[model samples]
Target: MEQRVDRVEQRQDRLEDIVATMGELLIETREMVVEMRRENRQTRRIWIAIARKQELFDDDEFQDVFGDE
Candidate 1:
């Protein structure tokens, strides 16, 4: 009976450890997701700027500003 109790305690300790580790991993994953979203926003802004530049190049007034590239 005592050995059975001891085995149960050991299993409980291991389960607790697993849960704690999983919690830590969850937090890290959340932080990484936020960082990725920030990077995605920065990339989107760069794309928008590039598109605007392309539109300007197609405009007739482009020559008035830069005077022939």
Candidate 2:
């Protein structure tokens, strides 16, 4: 009976350790997801700016910038 109790206690300790590790992993994953989202927004803004610049350069007033057709 005493040996059985000791085994149960050990199992509980192991489970507690696993839960703590999982919690830490979850927090890290959440932070990584947030960072990725921020990077995606920054990338989109850069692309939009580049597209606008391209449009400006395509206008008739800026045609000389590209030389003959």
Ten consecutive residues with minimal summed lDDT in candidate 1? 60-69
Question: Candidate 2, after superposition: displacement of residue 59 in Å?
Answer: 13
lDDT tens per residue, model 1, 1-69? 999999999999999999999999999999999999999989867765675678856556655554534
Model 2 pairs in collision = none
Model 1 C-alpha lDDT versus the unseen true structure: 0.81
TM-score of 1: 0.79
Q: In order, how many clashes per candidate? A: 0, 0
Worst 10 residues of 2 by lDDT: 60-69
Q: Candidate 2 residues 8-67, lDDT tens each?
A: 999999999999999999999999999999999898677656755778665564445443
Which segments of candidate 1 are over 4 A away from where they belong? Answer: 56-69
- Stretches off by above 4 angstroms in model 2 are 56-69
Query: lDDT of all predictions, in order shown?
Result: 0.81, 0.80
